[model samples]
Target chain A: MEAPATNNQIPGELGIWLFVAGDLIVFSVFFILIALGQKENADIFVQSRGKLDLWVGVLNTLLLLTASWFVAIAVERCRTGLGATASRYFSLGILCGVGFVANKSLEWGSKITQGINPATNEFFMYFFVFTGIHLLHVLVGIGVLCLLRSVSRSPGLNERRIRTLESGATFWHLVDLLWVVLFALLYLL
Target chain B: MLPFFYMGVFAWSGTFCYRVSLGTWFAWVMLLIYYVVKAIDRVEQEETASAQGQRYALTSCAGLLRNLAHAFGWENELKEKNVDPLFRKSMVFCAWSGLIAIVLFIIGGVILGEMLPPLLRANDPPEEFVRKVNEHLLSIRIGSVFLMLSFALFGPFGAGIAALTRRAEKSPVFSYVQLVFTSCGTLVAVLVAFTWALMAFRPDVYHPTTVQMFADFAYFLAVFSVPVFGGWCVVIALPILLAEEGQECFPRWVGYVNLWAVLLFAPGQLVLFFKEGPFSWHGIVALWIPFVAFFLWILIMCLSMLKAVKADDQVTGP
Candidate 1:
């Protein structure tokens, strides 16, 4: 009840954390279910996995990882009062998101052709559900970055500029984190 | 998949999404429930007027007893100056919301059942079908019940309470609770629609071919997350309300209720992950919400009393 913060309180780390929490809970649940179900249909999942070209997942992962790195640098610049520079880097981050989605589309197309219908195999079903849902979030984050770059020219924007970078960075990193857990669970392990 | 340009416009502008495929059978069912509640209100009002003439003070109060049970020791708390009046009112609304949720859930479920394919019923005569029915029926029915209740009771109750909790300066968490609860309510409404869609889309689920059943169930759960993704808002927002009065971060009861949701949901989602051939994941999904919802109802009663106990009696005549 301390006189409420105004509509835009220069949305801080808290905003990013909340977004990450929701995303993480969802992916975790989806992955955990897949893991638990894997035991019930290991052969089905493994065979389904064989059909998937994980090189695309690998490329998507690297793109996201690299994007998060560049985004971090963008946030560091914003902290140092380099707003214009931060804006430029955010555009680059958006590029990374676009790349990941393109690769995903190719990967998805091949699977559909191979008759790996999500409903057919438990593994393939989760594969489509989890990744497809995640791809949507990636696009959302990309859109956020693109939007941030557009109106970032106003004076005295620095105080909250880091937040713009931070939310996008948080989302990108979470995408990477999920892929990491997913890579091991889905591929190597 | 939405195109890049569309995502760009929505993301940059922070679009206001008021989507609910409103022209569905569930929309009609919701209208029916609304009409029934209105009728009940009118008839009850007339009965109250008639009974008042016969008895000096009507004591055949069926609702009154439940109201009393719902009342936490708040009146005494108010007398002793232990809580804030605004907080007390909000808690009182929470109690009413809980009650409305239970009643509406049953009504929604029965109405929804009217639309389902007759083949989904447990009474279908084939033995193989009967075996699948027994395996999946309980979980399916229970999930369906909670799914309906989410619309009828849960979301509206939260939104109603948050609306009542309005503050001139806006309590940060409290103000946010309104949007959160309203979204929760809306998600439930959509899920109720899907129940009819999936069943109607595949009436032969009662006697599905092996490949057909697997695809049907998998596809349903995947799409069904339209609600889960939305429902987590409650999980997120409840902590904000429970964090009031600078107590422990979340309401002690909410942590308990969430734990209940998890306890109920986790195992079922897991079993469902493995359940094949004529099982009811939807039913399993419904069973988790009500028991914990009612349990939270009890907690609100205790909180309301504690709130009343904490009420500041000074300048209270207003």
Candidate 2:
């Protein structure tokens, strides 16, 4: 197999890139919407923000970042035809996703137990709704990575398959990136 | 009665108004009559199939009929051809027929239904609701006619989506699935619209409780029937998402749009839990968001279909 001739070659399918771009736009719009909501009710948002456990947000952020690193390495290994190492890396990446989900569930469970939900107030509404949507994205990203991991383990993985792996990795990274912003916006800010 | 006969004639003729040949009018009329009969039978046989189950079966049957439509569209083409050039062009035209339905629904549902009876936001008292229904009886009657016309267009819209989705497969399985989901969705739309019509038809005659019951029935079905259309989105999006690199029926962005639309539609389920606020049938979360998202979905699909049809036209130049 020949290496890609161009220095600036796109890593994945054009389709995935289009999807990622759309996802980013949607999240950006959500961020803006929440910011406006904060402006309207600063006191409630500030109080609600304080109620959140910042450590959980930080921990989830770190998990996603580490997951991104593992997936990046996995994509490189797949491109280099290192099937076993790539599979191992993908497994680690998936574990990180699981960790993030578990952390999120605990955080939400704590809030619900304290009688906080979307209908609690304007701040909690945005917190729950936006995070709920982001959590969905994270779940889907994990599913995509799982499929890529299995595909990576095949001995007959081809150039096209490597590109597909890279595409899936890009999406996983986007999920992480969005969570980082969400962590800061909802939890830190 | 004379006006209704005129509307029926208009609607019947409207079926043939698509770029479809006049020769097929007889067949289209027969199909319409068959569904009308089926819908009536389903209504009468209330004990047999749950409303949801009946809708599911009806949609599946609609899917089969869409396959038949595809067969007719591609009669002269190769057996393995997924999309006919003619079908691509005509399907867009058929899809635009939905605009007729949209206009009618807005007029009937938004303007008239909401005004006289206030059927959608059912927080009013029995006497108040009954009094309003009686007050503007004529407006409600006129609105129901437009609503009926609107629901009638789902047939063409389902057929159009099935035909368009054929671009993704050599076999007609996905297309058939699209058809079935869309067909059942149409039935739900018609039934809900009919409930509103039934409420308005004899507002003065029926007891207030009976009128309120019809309103509740219509709102619940209209708001909660998300899965019906969501299934249509899923089947259509799967093909586009999985289609080979350049062979995609529409751009990949359209598939993502479908995904987002499906997500937005998910909130409709909240209606069952919350009777007020954003989760209620009239609330922002359940009714408004999903409704807007649906129209946006329709608009984007229309644009994509038209673009595909134009590209096909260029490929098969006159």
Candidate 3:
């Protein structure tokens, strides 16, 4: 996206920022809840932390980060009027998103098959609920990426289309950013 | 005056006698008939005045009928006269329905129903659940009555919103969608109240597990049914967000508010997964966040709708 001709210009419409800010505050609360849970059940949390496959978490993190990167480049391409090229980047971003979803489902499926679920323990409860919510975001982000891809393939990007593109990208980054926190909190920490 | 009399008598009977007497029911029926007659009388007056080419002062009942007529897309019939004030007044009243609902829900569902600190946890034993229900049986029954009344007001509240949305659109598709979802959401809320009342209705006769089942149904109905409520928010937000500049139904921030509500409510779906902790029915994410968000959404939408109505008054003049 073109740099704001003036510093006063926000990256996207002001409305999206309102949504982003509200979402971030709620996620902050989720993180705090996790911290409190970990403090109260340190042993259970630690034990459950070991059972998590670190590599799966690592793969998901990389996939989301790569997707975010592709989306960022796509937004820039759209700004430079490279609509065709931008469409390609959005597709790659979508591919990474699909990969993340597939990997996440596999991880969840294996856990379920092993008789581990949200109700198994407090730690798994947090793990499943929080990650599950984040997974929802990923799914939404992929749909949004598809929209951006189609928009990029269209001719003559107008100011409104660009705004839509920017807002969608911002949302995708939010999904990516949230997953990063989820990966660290649920897995590494 | 009659409506006030009806309310006063009903409230007095409900509080003192714990039951509405036959007299109160007769009075309620009379009030309904009065409303219908008064509404028709005003419409006849308007017809005569217009035939004689004289403007008639808008009465309360006539204003309501006009608002209803407008809501049903009969605007062409009333296009000649200045109906802005009447429409604005009715819209304002409809907007306040949401605020009234929030206040009543707090009193009826949270305070009186003893749901807020949650009377029983999801994993609590059935006997414990029954014991608690028995203890608060009177309050629960009374509260459920208030809750049912409060939740039903959402129908009018949603109608107000859909009406405003209809004005902003060239076609009324989203407004209809909003109305449909509003009915669904309102029904879900009323079902919550009904289920709670059922839980307390015959706790002595029913098995402990039966009471527990009722509690489960109530909580799940209230919290876990996210899509209906979320869809309501989405339709509200989408119209505002997609409206062309200067043609928006609500302010852009209001759309964002609805979007935020949709996100906050999503956690409610997790209540189905966890029986305890923050994801449980009684927990912060599952219950508190969504509950608080819903009222806040109602409050914001109410204020915005009121503001939008007032803005219409200025644009169209007195």
Indicate which candidate wins on TM-score: 3
lDDT of each: 0.51, 0.74, 0.83
| TM-score, every prediction | 0.51, 0.69, 0.80
lDDT of 1 by residue, B1-318 (tens): 245445445444543421111113323433344454345335534544554554433344734754665596545543333335665565556556655554444333433332122123222334444354445454445545554554544554555444433432134554465557456545545465455334434334445443234333433443234335234434544554345332333223233333333323322332234333212333322222332333333334333333332332433653
lDDT of 2 by residue, B106-136 (tens): 6676566562223446567778768877786
Docking class of 2: incorrect
Query: Model 3, stretches more than 4 Å misplaced?
Result: A1-6, B1-83
**Cα lDDT tens digits for candidate 3, A1-189:** 986466434576666776888889999999998988999999999999999999999999999999999999999989988888899999999999999999999999999999999878889988988898888889988998999999889999976688789989999999999988888988998
DockQ of each: 0.01, 0.16, 0.24
Off by over 4 Å in 1: A1-12, A158-161, B1-91, B95-152, B155-318
lDDT of 3 by residue, B126-201 (tens): 9999999989889889989888988999999999999999987877899999999989999999999899899999
Chain A only TM-scores, each candidate in turn = 0.85, 0.95, 0.96
Candidate 1, DockQ score (0 to 1): 0.01
| Residue B32 CA displacement from its true place in model 3, Å | 38
Candidate 2: deviation at residue B178, Å?
Answer: 2.1
Highest DockQ against the true fold, candidate: 3
Task: Report the number of the highest-lDDT candidate.
Answer: 3
